[model samples]
Target: MKNVFIFTVIGLLFLSCKPEEKRTDYIINGDASGVYNGVRAYLKEKDRTGRERIVDTAVVVNEKFTFTGKVDIPKPSVISINSVNGNLNFMLENSVIDISIDKANISQSQVSGSASQTDFDAYNQGYAKLKKESVDLQNELRNIHRQLSSGSSEQLQSKKDSLTDLFTAIRQKEQDYPLNFTRTNTDSYYSLVIIEREINKKNANIKDYQEAFNNLNSELQSSAAGLYIKANLTTLMVAFEAKSRVDIGKIAPNFEAPTPEGKTVSLNDIKGKVTIIDFWAAWCGPCRRENPNVVNIYNKYHSQGLEIIGVSLDGTRSQKDPKQAWVNAIEQDKLSWTQVSNLSYFLDPVAQLYNIQAIPAVFILDAEGKIAAKNLRGNALEAKVKELLAL
Candidate 1:
C-alpha cells in the first residue's frame, strides 16, 4: 500500500512537470455593446515557412456584449484586432486579452496592448522640434527681408551679406544638432561593444550599413522613426556600396534583356550617354502613377543623350498579360524608352542584388558606368537630367 501511494505521487509530479505545448487560440474580451461593428479578431502567425496564417472567429462576450474567446496560441504569437471604429490597433501576449471600447462613433478602437507611449513621445518631440525650427527660420528670413526693403542700395547689400551669414550659421547649427542627437541616441540603443563591432566589421566602409541594418530587431526595422534615428543609415550604406562596387568615370553595370519588340538590347548599346534604369512593375501602383513623370523626362531629355531602360518585375503570376500590359502602358503613356523584363518578376536577380524593397525605384548612371543618383523621381529626376545633360 505504501509503494502504491508513493508511485501514484511520483506519477502526478511527473505529469505536472511535463512542459505544455504552445497553442493557438481566439481570445476576445471587450465592450461589444453600443454601436460597435466591423470588429475583426483573428490569429495571425508567421510560421516556419515565413508565410502568414490568419484564423478568424466570432467574438464571445457577456451580458454587456463583451467578447471573449480562449485560444491555445503558440509562443511569440501576433494578434491583430481590426475595428473600423477609430481604427483600433492592439497586440496580445500569452492567453486572455480583454478590450473595452468606450468610443462609439468609430467602428473599432482601443485594441489592447498595442499602444507604445515611448514611440509616441519620441516622435512627438522630434516633430515639435522640427516645427519650431521651421517657424524660427521663417521669422528670421522675414526680418531680414524687411530690413533689406527699408535700406538703401549699399545698406541693403551689407544687410543681405549679414543675412546670408546668419542663414549659413543657422544651417550649420541645424545640421550639427541632428547629428548630435542621432549619435547620442545611438549610444543609448546600441552598446559600445556592439557599435565598435559594427564599425570595425565594416572597416568604416559605408556599404556595410545594410548588414548592420539587417541586424536590427524586426520592430525597430519596421519603424521609420527607428530608422530615422539610425541617421539615414540605408542611404549611407547604399552610397558606400556603390562607391566600392562601381568606379567613377567608368562604364556602369550593363546587361541585356528582350524588349517588347522581341529584340535584345544591352546597356553598352545605349552607351555614350546618361541612362536611367527604372525598376518597376505593372502591379505597382506607385510605378504606374510615376509613369507620367518618367514619360516627361524621356521627352525632355531624350535628344540630349538621356536614355531610359525600364526593367519590369511583374512576373508571370500576375493577373494581367505581362507583354501586352507593358506594351499598352508604354504606348498609352508614350514611354519611348527601351523596356525589358527577364520574366522572373519580384525574384529578379538584379533587384535582389540591389536590395530593392519597393517599386518606382530608379538609378541614374552618368556617361560613365557609375551610379550618378538613385530614386530620382518627380522634380528631382528632371533637375538631375537637365543638370547632367546640360539641357
Candidate 2:
C-alpha cells in the first residue's frame, strides 16, 4: 500500500517534469543540390515593424540542411545564405517544413510540409503570374516605341495609344489584387501580410488601407501588424494628403513644439499675426545658405506684423544633442525669429502633420492663421510677406 502511494507521487512528478515539445518545436529540412556543402544558413524573423531577427543558424551538410527550434507563434521568416543572399521566405508555422531546391534556382524550388506555407506558396504563385503580365505589357510598349523611333511611324500612334491604355489597366490590377485578397480572406493571417505591403508604400493610399483594415478578422486585427497600422495609418493619411494640407485655402494645421528655452510653443501662441512657418535644419546646407535672405526679410517685416516661426529639424540621431545644435545654429545664423524643435528630425510631430518632405520649406499664413502661400523662397517669400502684411 505504501509502495502504491509512492508510485502515485512519482507519476505526478514525471508528468510535471516532462517538457512541452509539440507546441514549441519546429523542424526545417532542406535539400539544395547545387548549393555547396557546409554553406551557412540564417533563419531570420521580424517583429511587426519588419525589423529582422536572426533567431538561429545552420550549416548545409552533404547537400542537405536542417533547423530545429521552438516558437510560441508562427512568425514571418527568411531563410537565407549569409545575411543578404535571401533563399526564400515562408510563414514559419510550427510544423516540419521541407524545402527542395534544384540546380541553383531558388525560384523554382518546392517548399512543402506546413499547411500555412502551402497556402502562402499557392497565393504567391498566382500573384507572381499577375505581376509578370504587368511587366510584359511594359516591355511590349517599350519595344514598340523603339521600333517606331528607328523605323517608319505609320500606324504606330494608334498602337501606342491602345498599348498605353492596356498598361494602365494592368498596373491598376496589380495594385488592387492584394487589396481584394485582404478584403475577402478575413480568417487567414496572411491577409494582414498583403495589406501591410500596401500600407507601407511611399505615400500610402488612405481609402484602400481603411477598407482592408476594416475587413481583417478580430484575431488578426489585434496582432502586431494590425497594431502597427493602428499606430501609423493616421499619420500616413495626413502625409499622403499633403498637397491639400499645404494648399493656400486651408486652415493651417496647428502644431505645438518646444522652444529653445524648453517651453512649449504652438501656432496658436502667435495667432493674430501673419506667420511664416519655415522648415529648416541645422545640418541642411541650403537652409544655412538661405538664412541671410530670411534674416533680412524678418528684420524688414517683423515690425510690420510679419512673424516667423523657424521649425528646426535637428538633434534626432544619438551622436548629437538637439538643444545645443538648435541654439548654435540660431546664434551662428544670427536668426532673431522664434525657433522650435521636437528634436526628432524629419519625423517631428509638426513635420509629419504638415507633410514637410523637403528642407527649406516655407508656409506663409495670413493674419487669421489661414495658409497664404507655400514653399516661396527668397524674393517670392519676401514679396508674399510684404503683400500679406500690406493687406
How well is each residue in 16-117 modelled by candidate 1, as lDDT tens digits?
Answer: 999997444434555555533555545454443345676444443341233344433212233444552343333333344556554554333434432232
- Which lDDT values do the candidates have, in the order given? 0.60, 0.80
| lDDT comparing candidate 1 with the true structure | 0.60
Candidate 2 residues 29-127, lDDT tens each? 988676777788778897667878888888888878888988655566877774224467788877888888644545566778776676577678878
Residue 331 CA error for candidate 1 (Å)?
2.3
True-vs-predicted CA distance for residue 27, candidate 1, Å: 44
Deviation (Å) of 179 in candidate 1: 16
